[model samples]
Target: MKLEKELIFPKGFTVRKVIELVTANERFASKIYFQTKSHQCNGKSMLGLMSFMLMTTIGESYIISVEGEDAEKVIQFWNKFVREIHENTTLSYWEEEGAQTVQEAMCQSISFWNSSVRSVAQSYLKPGKKEI
Candidate 1:
């Protein structure tokens, strides 16, 4: 079974705070994952959570989905947690995609190619293959 919900946080709530709360409850945290359009992270990892750069701004939405036996309980916990922390926060659906400048594109391209996994798998991974 799985449980899922979408939510936003309060302006004062930081990702670090999220890390503390999520990790504090190991049993619940281990059963869930959080996702946004471009990023997904384990609820229990500070670094993984940081990599998403989650913000408490209006319109940005996050999806919390949990698996395993306690999925319902974990989902309920996160739902209540977000509501309590961000009572007055507005909720909206923000489109997370957009175009970028030529310079920005170049930088992103370089970053992807130079990223740890990409750098190592450059030769092994490619756009297409002729097939056998």
Candidate 2:
């Protein structure tokens, strides 16, 4: 599935809010499919979604690209819920905790690979030879 468009929620969007919205409407939640990250996939877990919130000072928008079997439904529910929340609730923006960037994650993976390769090289080489 692919997102027909990107949906940007206002600054106060949070995982808790998402859960609330989903829980409030059971039909929408039941349709979610677990897929790898993409325009169609949630790419985020329930815990992750619940943890995310907009930053207050900047009031940063949450960018969600909806793609999946139920993307349209989720988007429709979320859009309607956001409008309702804005009008009816006093929202508090919570900052999402820091998460490793793709680059940082890749570097960590490479570091592990390098170390493992060195270890294997050492096992095959003479004691005085370079590990690489």
Candidate 3:
């Protein structure tokens, strides 16, 4: 099984959040990849993620692809995680930090999904196999 979703980095999102995401990915058996328009890397690899992050900016969108027995669950987890970040950032800036108005927060927040969830047939190779 394979599941994919495009996600935008929310406001106040940082490298620490990416590390948290990668850590969550490591907890599962599923293989995950994060892809920007110009690059893609294994979501489970710290080095790969760090390199990928360097090329991406806040508010940039990326696709996350998950494959293996837990693909659906992985996708679900990511959806919830992203939503939490989005909501928390919005609320924190508006209410807690008082750095921005609610309107400003809403406008500045990166849109989480530019596209809907896509289910596709397996196309990525397993470990030790070249991707076709």
Candidate 4:
């Protein structure tokens, strides 16, 4: 089976969120790839994802292709993951102190990657409903 979807990063989206996607890909047997206008890379590779991210900006759409026995499952996971990221970005931007703008929230999220406060930002990445 094979599935593909075009998805856009919501406001306040950061590289750390890409890490979440890469991590999730590890659970499936699917061979997943992410494509931007100028580049394409394996979804399971952090370096590839980072390189791909460089060619795009927030709100820009990209295509994700998944193929294998678990393609449907991988697609479902992405749908839920993207929805959660959007919802959490909205909530975190408004709810977190000192984050008066979406960009601030994004910067804060990047900073979270290094400190103990990472857990706080990571909470935003948690799936809202049941896991796929």
13-71 per-residue lDDT for model 2 (tens digits): 55567678546544543344222123222324454444343222223333555555777
- Residue-level lDDT of model 3, residues 1-132, one tens digit each, is 888989885554567987898899999999999898899999899889888877766578999999999999999998888788877664343434332243344334325313221111112223443222
TM-score list, all predictions: 0.55, 0.42, 0.60, 0.62
Q: Considering only N, C-alpha and C atoms within 3 Å, which residue pairs clash in candidate 4? A: none
1 versus 3: better lDDT goes to: 3
Poorest lDDT segment (10 consecutive residues) of candidate 4: 123-132
Please give the clash total of every predicted structure, in order. Answer: 0, 3, 0, 0
Task: Report the Cα lDDT for candidate 3.
Answer: 0.71
Give the deviation of candidate 1 from the true structure as CA RMSD. Answer: 11.2
- In order, candidate lDDTs are 0.58, 0.47, 0.71, 0.73
> Candidate 3, which ten residues in sequence have the lowest lDDT sum?
116-125
TM-score winner among the candidates? 4
Error of 3 at 86 (Å): 1.9
| Cα lDDT, model 3, residue 41 | 96
Candidate 4 lDDT, 1-132, residue by residue in tens: 889889885554478887887898988999999887778999899998778866666677889899999998998888888787777775353533422254345445574365655555555443552221
Among these predictions, the greatest lDDT belongs to 4
Off by over 4 Å in 2: 11-16, 22-44, 54-58, 91-132
